[model samples]
Target: MKQNLLLFSIGIWLFSCQPGAETGSTQISEESIKTHIEVLSSDDFQGRKPFTEGEIKTVNYLVDRFKQYGLEPGNGDSYIQEVPLVELTAMPSETMTIEGNGQKVELKVLEDFVAYTEKVVEKTSLNSSELVFAGYGVVAPEYNWNDYEGLDVKGKTVVVLVNDPGFASGDSTFFKGETMTYYGRWTYKYEEAARQGAAGCLIIHETVPAGYGWSVVRNSWSGASLYLDQTGGSYQPDVLGWITRDAAIKIFEASKVDMKNYAVKSRSEDFNALSLGLSASVTVSNEINRDKSQNVIAKIAGSEAPEEYVIYSAHWDHLGIGQEIDGDSIYNGAHDNASGIATMLGIAEAIANMEKPKRTVVFLAVTAEEQGLLGSKHYAQNPVYRPAKSVANINMDGITAWGPMKDLTVVGYGQSELEDIAEDIAKGQGRYIIPDPEPGKGYFFRSDHFQFAKVGIPALYASGGYEHMTKGVDYVDSLNKVYLTSQYHRPQDEYNPETWTFDGMKLDGELLMEVGMRVANSAEWPTWKEGSEFKSIRENSMK
Candidate 1:
């Protein structure tokens, strides 16, 4: 009863404090948000995975809701944008052999290492491919750092570190310090290795620098993976994988090199790729399936400048079914993203009733985010609206379900002026905007907003604050820790309307709605901050 009373009080407070209250244009519905999350996260939705019956149901449901809310189809004549994806499911041999100097070592699949092939071939093999230690596998002209300098790694395996030099050295002068530039991402490492003409790329995973455990790598890479189907094959390594730190240590020891000393030396610009005198052999059989996924898009055209757009995006895909735990196989990603979709729905409904702004507003529910932001990447590459005309992208990945808070946390806080607008609106709600507490984890780069950001559009991604209304900071922190360890990416992430609160999620939806409105109405474009790497990209794009 106490919790119920608190929720009622929050609703009343929000109703009184809403910026649109005086004008009576639109009011957010917390119950509607709760209902959307409940249905989307329910068992019947089959976890809302793409390329299955779940995707059919999910997209149809979104289109129905958008029509009910009177939102026009965002695309020319349809609410769905077809995204062509190729699914690669690698069936590796039980064991992989590493041999060098007349000595052989066998690594168990999914236990010591996890690997897959980007090539869409039935059989992919590596026979005694020489292994070289390429530090971080980065070649950035801006940073003047080249890990593959003077090294020819064609038809060989390049062992790379997970993150960049700045993360290891803790120096502000190198690669954005601990903030994790795009160079630090594992995707970047694989791409760079492929560009260097390497046949295989293996990232050495440490929990601290990788920001995730070995279990994540194992589970995520073990199952069927989706990628945008390339017409004539792209520059991707034949084998991309992650080796546990223990496995890497053993490999280094066998190669007669100290892993710790090499890691330290790799942080410096003068470091060169080391020949490990090792060779790797493996064969992977893949079951390849090609399919078309849809990105649900709905729009409210502008009253005046309808060509200019403000995009609101949230991914609608999750890990469908994989290894089971506690007799449950479904990974019902309620908090991971169902909440985010719910927030999007709430924003869409609210905006539908509001006075049409001068610029267009788009609500996009993208697919295949759980498989490395593929949906957003496709949209960024082939947007329905020209990238230059899109004003900004506001992404909501995982909104808080733990009730109201006194502040909001903005991911990628200082990268764009959109955050300034978010902060101003947050202040109007008696809340302040705070930077992400764990910047080292690189939450900003891990979401859909990053796709838009890469294409020179100012994007904003944020979540509810940690300072809870009823419960204090300590409780909120503990709750977050519990969620991260116990529920994140697991089957336990289900919606429980009896216990879960939508107050915080509703607040975040309101903030996003207000930000979208302000951006849509404004004449000026939001640009990246002065020192941001994306600033020049945005300027060039505008030109």
Candidate 2:
């Protein structure tokens, strides 16, 4: 009787340990996620900075995890995709001299202005370059607006305002009305200036419209900046930078233009680019370094349509060691990305244990995301699986740590059908979907998913909901505000396993798994929404 009882107990334990045995559903292991986060965010990883020892450890760790999960190599016979990058550390002059209307104004670095050069040269100088106030510096034909209309800015410096007219005027008919479009992005301003053959671009930064303080701009752009190698040739402005509102006011005063009047007038479609009658003279010295980073790629090939793929992505790099703050130098990006990578591992493990999917599921851990999404951008441009063959891309960036919530926030909500799928999955999990809380920040274009989206692949980027289960909405709101103000991109973003909660992160991982599984099993290919900016790109790729 004792021997029979022992045998029966052993059998029951084995059954419970099997995947899909618990409640007839396959669940991601919370223990596995905890271990992954603790290890990835540990100080020994040195913040996982690209091209450093930290990056080497991070890539190895991810590759080992993928191998342990029984995933095949995503990039032909290799688990790594090399990303060639050029690191440019610009050392600008102490003072930027601006002369206008028989007056000279010197702007201080870090305090009054922040600037850099992307010219990839040892030394670059702007010797009395003509400065033109280009009013937002946008030329969007769709909006019937062109700030550079009938203006030739070649070899000149263009100064533009941050955000768009809709944000400034709060007019619904302007450009998405308070919700910043791509044109509102600072990157767009620089790119537009470069397209118009400008030698330099400076964005006037207002905290409200720019979404962050001047300190963020200083900290982010002051140090080493990396860009994908464009040895073949790329159009980039000779100088790119930002000026504080005070500095802009000073310049306007020197130029004899009412700064407030010009700001108000810029909102109108009839606004024209005004020559500031100012000349800028500054020298930029660069210390250039070339290195190779990598994107760790793994895959679970489909049994049937092996050519088609569904991608799961997360960036594994952070702002590495920098100027010490409060005796701490390492920016251990725990919530920024360690949580996302942990979630991706959990999903990978769950998928590995399931039956073969009908479409290939690729797990990609990209590098250099903090340095402008370089790894993902390279993959999107030179993909292992063609964009036309990919079903969808689901990216996990920073996941909420404040516990489970009642809703999920979808970034770029209406741009693709992937959101509909994610919405249904969230609904099944007893949660609803909400658009991004801060739409003017353009969070959708700020992640790795944007790279895939640009290549015509429908992508989904969502965050843990704002309404917490126990803490409620007010608590969640306060927590978000605190995080943005105190912890984001700072050395204080360390991992404290004792205080962290994986409940919401786990739920989000499960939802992503469900969406990916459903898309993989179905024959339908997710596409951009009918009127989405990416719709034409998708249609053309499919053709």
Candidate 3:
């Protein structure tokens, strides 16, 4: 999308008032970004997972940095914001019993299936629960689709597909086509099942739609699962899990149901729920621990309108020590988010060193984002700076490592006016703004920025890795492929000084600093674009 030159001119004049501010961005150098990433992604931090020693180390490091930089604690004299959470480590039966229609099959745990529950209890189980095939498990009224319109799954188990109906339907008008909406997310499916009073919800996982392999599911679900302490009696399914496509096919065959036919029918709006004529029984013993994780928040107070704010956010958590693979166990989230945290820190330091903007500028390092964006979600619900006062949120999830690129990949592009600002910044740096290369992967909703977006705060999540400065797009793609194939969410994602470069991150950090500074200084607030789902949210909240 081309930026309106008129808005670009206005933005230029708006931010040009910050005297010597361009030099502030230059202070975000490669050395600073590399130092932060190296320390955060090191094995000594133990993966930076919440509710562990890693959490303590990670949060303390952030707090210490903020103090050293002479920034104020964002949370009322305390840099730490406690996010209450419950960790449930489930020991499920080795096999799940699936039987009916004179046939029976045992689904192996961590192989054919992976299951766990978030209901903070010592034990939760589904006993002989009748199985029902629920298409997508969505009830999006705006789309006029309800997979459970006339079905009652109370005390039963639901079998839903990985993505929404538009996964491969190629109908752009339908559910945003291949770009997965919140309805397509597995988190949404489990929430919908619990809303329908179902005892269990199992999403059938396939590589393309689920966006990862079964190994990811096995490793993620094998460890202790964390949930924002649902102390107010919010209900969750007794059994929430995923079954490999092969396992789902096997179970469907045993129930005498044609899996292919059901999958085909599920893509249509007229499709209805069908009972699989099978009963699923699984028992899981849970070890529950209620704990608190810290969200490190530090701020540079405004020289003028201090109540209004511009925010920078990044999640500081990753999969702790997990299923050992390739003779390694630590899931050092270098690219997954250590890079993001590093970038945010670099930007924060640069901005703090310069003259303050009109509105406060905050840097937030949140916890449990890998768990499910829980820390940001909690902060959004209980905020020190109200959403209405927040001018914008600039989030960094992962930074490019294959050197600077010509294209700035904006995740969730066209959602808000923040993209327009990003466009101006990118053009100034001899780069162009482009939409996410893999929008179907739902990178926007997968990050902590979505939490801020949900509450009407315009957020920017953009990076430059699509078209490398010297090597071009194909070279960047190859490196990205290698990381996704081997190191993504795995132990191999460690800092290798010989291979990793911080020049690109330095490029991004500088631009991100300008984005926040512009928003903080400008009197005009950014808003969700006309067709965005979040438009009405800001409208209702401001009222």
Candidate 4:
């Protein structure tokens, strides 16, 4: 009953905000952010890999800290939300082979492409099934395009090229112009193929088109892949993987087709799935395991509208012990996500020390984000509060350890009114907002915010700026380019305060707090932009 009254009181407080005056300035301290980052990025955590001992240690630490700050459990009586996961590693029978019209080509997994099975079976295979070259493998009724039009893809392997045609054509008018929509993502392609009853799926990889090289895809997917246990979920393709362009050319030539013409024809809207006139056969054996992960949740209830909430999220998992490089076996993820988790905890501390918000606020440290956004997906599918009552999601993915930049880069910038709120808060501190330069990378769909977006919640996953002050923008860009190439997802990602700038991270945390706090105190809920695919969902949920 006390909790019920407190929630009702917070609702009352929102109407009492003094009009025509700047609400009192938030007092977020730099010392708090510094302290949180220091401990999270420390070596004792062993990179906080989910399903490992590190995860237990990390969750205990966060929950203990939340207690110290007087925060309540987000879920009744507990601070953890259990996320069930199953890890399956796909091992091919041998090398995957392609044969068509008296010609044969052999491709090795991990060298030419990385393939994995999503099926729960012990073994699966495809033999002599015809291949179909599906352009992007997208079936958008709204776009009046369907790659599977009149085609029975059952028991057939569908080959697709990465990204949308608009990416290469520089036609923003085609599909949100330069920005990558969900159609451009490889996961969606694979899902669509599986839904279409295709036997197998292979995505053709090009550096620019895929936003990364074949090596990245190989490294990320080659490890143990996790999926939610859907006892009766749609069947996954028998074979799933990617192939190099040269390898794709070999398959095309074997089919007695002009590789150049096939490539050019795929760029047109009228293009449909074509018979590759070849068959791909692969046998995959799986090592399956089941485990339960947890999402650590802490809350600061408001003085008034407790049912309404403002959420802040960060992923706590990183690549576990992997191939050793120079004897550093751990990928500490100090920068990839340790920094992000640290910022989330810091923001929680800052809020805990402030006057009570008008609405409840939740600080969520989710798991399995590195393994395809599992933790956040579960949360979105099973939210603590109805999606309509939640105000917004403020996510911190990769925070800058470099000193503060003059600009803040908002990923998926134009999708939400939250960006306007972010800009308002950023400008208040003499900083400016910038859109991501590499939108074609499909970064918006790559993080935890995407799970929330799928459920019609407005989310913002903004990271540190690559544009530096002392160094030129080009120099900053070069540094990121190098990180993306050598250090990302590699064992080389260790915490080195010497090379990092906490000033920027601290500033970013403050801006995030400001945004969340402002929304929590207001009666308004954010809306998606007009014409956005998610807009209608948000509108319906609000009603």
Which digits, one per residue and each the tens of the lDDT, describe model 2 over residues 452-519?
98789999999775899777899888988888788888888877767688888889999888878877
**TM-score for each model:** 0.89, 0.90, 0.89, 0.89
Q: What is the C-alpha lDDT of each candidate?
A: 0.84, 0.85, 0.86, 0.80
Higher-ranked by lDDT: 1 or 2 = 2
- Residue pairs clashing in model 2 are none
Q: Write the per-residue lDDT of candidate 4 for residues 463-489, one digit (tens) a residue.
A: 557677567588778878878778888
How many collisions between residues are there in candidate 4? 10
Q: What tens-digit string does per-residue lDDT give for candidate 1 at 235-294?
A: 588888889888887788778555677778899778889888899988888898999999
What's the C-alpha lDDT at position 47 in model 4?
70
Winning candidate number (lDDT)? 3
**lDDT value, residue 29 of candidate 3:** 65
- Please give me the total number of clashing residue pairs in predicted model 1: 0
Which is the better candidate, 1 or 3, if ranked by TM-score?
1
What global local distance difference test value does model 2 have? 0.85
How do the residues 19-130 of candidate 3 rate in per-residue lDDT, one tens digit apiece?
Answer: 5334443468688788999999999999998878998999989999999989999999999899999988889989999989998899999999998988877778889999
